[model samples]
Target: MKFRKVTETDVAKIVEMIADDELGKTRENYQIPLPTEYLIAFENIQADPNQELIILENENFEIIGTLQLSFIQYLTYRGRIRAQIEAVRIRKDKRGFGIGKKMFEWAINRAIERNAHLLQLTTDKKRQKAIKFYEDLGFKATYEGMKMHF
Candidate 1:
């Protein structure tokens, strides 16, 4: 397994993985000739030093997973860095193979490398499996997360 920053051509596949599941199917638009907005967002992320859009590849370099890591600098905690993981998805064929765990391990190491004081992520409550997986990785549900959709 390998983790690398996404290229423009990889956007469609990344969207596909994100849209494969039930909840994702409702939120992601993963069709061919993808909307221009996707590229625009990709460009924004690519240009930001604090954002990392990652693609996970197999031995043949096929994209099997994708995620985004954001390094946030805030006034809290004495201005320590916070690493936030988001949009995490593994290809349907790649699930149950421990690749996801490896991916999170990579993220943890990356957070450490970036001198981040904490690594955090928010998963949809509907995704019970994902929450359990995160818990198994040593994350705790220390607070209730609330969000307002615009």
Candidate 2:
């Protein structure tokens, strides 16, 4: 497996994976030709120096997973950098093959490479299994998170 920055062509595949899950099915609009907003977001992400929209490729060079990593320069923690991970998705068929673990390992290493003082991510509270998976990976649920959606 290889991890690399996503290309314009990979957007649809990425969207497909993102929409494969129950929660995602309610949110993403994956299609033969993805909506322009995804492409626009991709372009915006690509333009940001601290943003990494990554895709995981198998031996055949197929897109099997994807995640977004953002290095945030914040004032807390002594002005250190924090790496935030978001939109992680592994293909439906690729689930339970240790791919997610390896993907996260890569993200952690990349964060270390970028000198991030901490790595953070948020998953929906309804995803119990996902919460367990993250806990297994040494993440602590220390804070009670609240969000407001427009």
Candidate 3:
């Protein structure tokens, strides 16, 4: 497996991977013509120095996973930088192969390399399996996450 920054060409595959899941099927629109919003968001992310949109590929060069990491510099924690992990998705057929664990390990190492003092992520409450997976990977459920959708 190889990890690399996602390119503009990878957006379609990323959208397909996200839409493969139950929740994503409801939330993402992967219809014909595709959505301009996704590309727009991708470009925005690409332009941000603090944001990293990554893709994991197999030996055959097929994209099997993806995630985004954002490094924030804040006054909290003595002004230390914090890394936020988001939009993590592994191909449905690729689960249970210990790939997700490897992905987190890579993310953690990447955070350390960037001098981030803390690494964090928010997962939907409905994803019990994912919650367990994260806990097993040494993430603590220390706070409640709240969001207001527009």
lDDT of each: 0.93, 0.95, 0.95
Q: In each prediction, how many residue pairs overlap at the backbone (N, C-alpha, C within less than 3 A)? A: 0, 0, 0
Looking at candidate 2, what is the lDDT of residue 77? 88
* Candidate 2 lDDT by residue in tens digits, 37-106: 9999999999999999999999999999999999999998899999999999998888999999999999
Candidate 3 Cα outliers beyond 4 Å, as residue runs: none
Per-model TM-score, in order, reads: 0.98, 0.98, 0.98
lDDT of 3 by residue, 55-144 (tens): 999999999999999999999899999999999999989999999999999999999999999899999999999999999999999999
Give the per-residue lDDT of model 1 (tens digit) for 1-109: 7899999999999988888999989988888999888999999999999999999899999999898999999899998999999998999988999989989999999
Task: Please give the TM-score that candidate 2 achieves against the real structure.
Answer: 0.98
Question: In candidate 1, which residue ranges exceed 4 Å CA deviation?
Answer: none
Give the clashing residue pairs of candidate 2, or none.
Answer: none
Predicted structure 2: lDDT: 0.95
Off by over 4 Å in 2: none
